[model samples]
Target: MNWRLVFVLFAVFAVGTNALIMAGIVPAIATGLNTSEAIAGLGLTVFALTYAVVGPTLPIILSRFGRRTIMAGGLILFIGGTVLSGLAPDVSIFMLSRVIVGVAAAAIPPQAAAIAIAISPPGREGRALGLLSAGILLSIALGVPLGSLLGIWLGYSGAFLFLASLGIVGLIGLFFIPPTPKPAKATIAEQFAPFRRPAVLVLGLCAFLFAWCQYSITTFFAPLVKDSAGISDVEVPILLVIYGLTGVVAALFGGRLIDRFSGYAVAIGGFIAITITTPLFSVASSFLIAAIVVVVWSLAQNVTFPAAQVEMGRLHPANPATAFALFAALVQAGGAIGAAVSAGVLEALGPRWIAPVAAVATLIGTIVISLLARRLRRQNEAQSILVEATVDEAS
Candidate 1:
């Protein structure tokens, strides 16, 4: 294992922890800020919206800078924003802090994945990408739960502070990694060239849809679990850990599967699994049953990330950072929409509707992506046959 990559993974973990910690601590935030849980949950929506808006553009604007500068700058801003979130006296300020953090976060993960792909050994891209994706899962598994405990003990503000401290560690670690040279400047048209490909377009849609499905349920997970399983705030983290741990395993294993099989196949399998398992949340009447459903859903959901990332890298080999930034933006956009939509559903229809709605979204995404993948495969096969026929005729 390259120790440098480990630091990159750690950096991703810090960003992801901040991004997701709110899911575990939303009720505390609601109470502390004198707002409804639905309103407080908009903190995440704010972050995702900001990220979706900024993620694609900022990285391209900063394309001339080296990865080290971009990563370090992002961390500095992230730390500042997180600190603000911890210190904010009102919900407005807290939401503003999330915007700042989201902007900063926009620059990190896609760059981190690009760095990983750049530095990884040949034929191991899937594993490298998987390792980084696992950082997000690890944050869910460990960081969110631990943050929840801190929220229970100290306050929601304290949880934000703890996340800030992690960002500082990632900042220091960045200094030790080898410096990456800046790429030559390119025109805006060149930067957006990947969008011209049909495959990239379909994949972006898949990214958006899957993220929509996943976050719709997860952004409000604390309340959903409580409503469905009679679980308390303290117990929410335990189920999150189970979900996260299962995701971690799936991410690592999915990476190898992508390496051996096809990213398209692995991604489609993941989507199918999610579609099948997510609706089961409606029927989970006991903790054991809920946990079982969580484990299966986590396994299915986590695998899609690495597989999509690997496909993105392969599709835009010359400018992978651009592809990754686009994918990240779409994912955030979907998450923002999902969170906002689900909040309305929770307020009106109740938590029972969240799972079924999520499942429907995933099912739609699965069908669209599956059709596109099949077409792409057939095109490739046809091209191969044409080339072979020409060669045989010449011989």
Candidate 2:
């Protein structure tokens, strides 16, 4: 409802939108740079891999800067990257541009999320964080295809131009937003200290699994559609649209599930539900089945963070920003690893392997998550009993 959330959403939208635009422009980038499609795709892989590597580190480096200043700086980096990419005459320069974008985009999210939650009124955090998360989820759903379409219609230069323009709008929106005090600096090791909690560790691990599952299916979803259903090239984008629309619905409601039920419950429940849907996905051979499975996958995917954030807050009530930075970095790392692993599998096996691999992964993640849940419950009980004993003795 406030303008701050709007600005935060705008920043996230622009950053996420640009990151995904690479998938759309792969072929165009190849043609433009006179490289192979496989080599062109490295622009995305390198960006994601660097983001995974640098996401946690950026917050510390920007610790002395105001939140708005840091965000604006990131947008500037993105603009510069976009410009360089548009002008890049070689594959190496394009790859460099993508990495530059990755480094800047890394700084935006954790700081923005921290700002949103710090100012949020009690009990309304779920709502506020959901709004930010919704922006992120919506970008994946809506922007991917749209960016692809832009690339298709206007070519590489035009596609990069649209993305560069988005960075400008985001920067302007960020300029008007209020600045929060910079967070205290923490070394990477210290930032990760919160994971010393068993529950936090479990949450991080589950998030990793979620990323693996999502990237496996998503990176290859259209390819599966093409290979399995004999769908035409043009229809791929349309089917992807349906997949993204499902995410918007999920993002709108997933926060409530975390608010109403425990985040731990949502995590396990989401994985289980996905497990049921994976078989249907594996066998999908028509638009209808692809549509249904993709929606189910998106729904389950959207809930992972809201649910994890709830537990994260309960575990580290003091410093969610630092926690968020670590969580985000790990999530990106998981995605990078997932994409690499899935790509390897796809090469050796085939596209249909995506669903089965994801299905087995979900099951494994669920098992690990169940054990984690029990451990956290026990830890909570132990802490409660110690507190009660202290109170009784004091009386």
Candidate 3:
């Protein structure tokens, strides 16, 4: 494990922490801004939507720049936006600050992953990406709950301040990371060309649908548990910690399985399990059942994330950055759509329906992924034959 890879992991984790903090502390933010919880939740939608809409395009625009330039500048913007979020006096200002943070956060992860993969030792790409994925699980496990506790003690603004400090630390670490140049061989048209492939498009859709399932409930996880199960604010962190711990285990193992098996297999299996387990959450009326459901949900969801990245890397081995960028964008889009739609559903149907809806979404995703994987196999077989025939002719 190179120290620079550690820096990249931390950089990604720093941004990821803020995104998940809404899950644990939406009530605090709502109260601080004197807004409704639904409106406060919209802050997440804003951040996610901005990240989704703007993030993928950024890789293209910034492709001309070095990773050092892109990461350093994005960190500065991310840190500044986080500070602004801490100081925001109203919901409007808070949401605006989140947008800034969202766009800034969007630029860091794919570039960091690209650099990490480039420097990764041979046959260790899965392990390296696993570490990167672990950063995300750690943020959800440690950072979000801790931020919630901080909000309980210091105020919601204090939570933002803490997140800002982490961003600043990541910025400092950015300086120590070596520069990586963009792939000179990928033409601009080819950068977008992968989108036309059924395999890439389907995998991206899987990323989208999976994210939708996770974030739909997660954006409001704490409040829902409190309302439905009567869990106190003090117990919120514990529940989230359980979710995070389970997720960490799943992510680490999922990485190895993705290396041993194919990402297609892991994703299909995980998605089917997700479809089954997600609806179980709707029926979890007791704390113990809810906890179990949460753990299962987290495990199912977290395991597929790295697999999706691995699948995307396989889709375009020569341009992992581009592949990861598209995957990240779709994931963010799914999150944004999930959060936004769930906000409406929360107003109409309440939290209990969140998991059931997620189940339906994942069911759809499972079907599509299965079909896409079959198509990908056939395409690869045909290409193999073409290559063999070409070789035979030459001989």
Candidate 4:
């Protein structure tokens, strides 16, 4: 195993945690900032929104720099943002800090994906990507609960300071990482070419729609679970643990699924499963039932990511990092919209309707993408047969 790559992944995992787990401590943040919970939630909403917009642009702006240069610069921005956010005296400044983090947040997945794919081989792409995805799941598993605990113990500001400190640790770990050899270079327009491929376009659309549905409900999973199951506030962290742990297992298993069946299938099928379960989540009467459903949903969600990534690796086999980066960028784009909509859903229908509504959207997107996948598969098979026939004729 490549230790440098491992370090890169560890850094990525830690950074992803920083972006994602802040919401878990939002209540604590509200208290610290002397603001309403609603206001604190906006911090997340704003970061995601800015991250989405910047995700695409950042790669382009930083193209002149080496991947190592970009990654290091990005980490510095993340640590700076975290520190500023930690010290902010008011809610507005706190949000501004989050935006700084968002700028750095866009820089992470590309380097992480590049590192993961760089260290692996062709046939094992799915497995490698799966393990990388595992880092993401692991962070969720560990980061949120730990953050919540820190918030409760030392206050939200202290918790954020710790998070910033984690960013610095990741940066140091990343410094020990060896720089990846540059792949074939592309102009901005060339980098954007994948945007026009039918398969890529379809997947991008599917991602956005899927995000809209999934994020709407997931943003409020803790509260939803608590309310649905009548669980005490203490149980939220434990249940979140359940949710995160199951996702880790899913990452391990989902990689095999991708390696065997192809990433396209895993991507489409996972979303379908999520769509099917959305109703259950929306209406589960018992905490245990909701927990079970959330676990399944989280598992399925974990699979779709690596599956899509493995596909991206194969799809743009010539420029794997760029492919993965574009996929990561699209995820943020969809997430931005999804997160924004979730706030509206939370306010309008009391969270009961969000999952089902998202389910319907996922179902719709799945149908279109599944059809496209079939068409792509058939085209590939037909081309294979033609090559074989030509070889036979030559013999």
Please identify model 3 stretches exceeding 4 Å from their true place: 22-42, 88-95, 152-158, 185-187, 220-236, 340-352
| Model 2, position 81: C-alpha lDDT score | 91
Per-model C-alpha RMSD: 3.0, 2.6, 3.1, 2.9
Ranked by TM-score from best down, the candidates are: 2, 1, 4, 3
lDDT of 4 by residue, 218-302 (tens): 6777666665666777776776778778888888778778878878888888988888887787677776887888788888788
Write candidate 3's Cα lDDT for 124-160 as tens digits.
6666777788888888888766776888887888888
Model 1 deviation from native, Cα RMSD in Å: 3.0
Ranking by lDDT: 1, 3, 2, 4
Instruction: Give TM-scores for every candidate, taking all chains together and pairing residue i with residue i.
Output: 0.88, 0.89, 0.87, 0.87
- For lDDT, the strongest prediction is 1
Q: Which residue pairs clash in candidate 1?
A: none
Model 2: residues with Cα > 4 Å off, grouped in runs = 184-189, 226-231
Taken over the whole model, the C-alpha lDDT of each candidate is 0.85, 0.76, 0.81, 0.75
Best by TM-score: 2
Candidate 2: what lDDT? 0.76
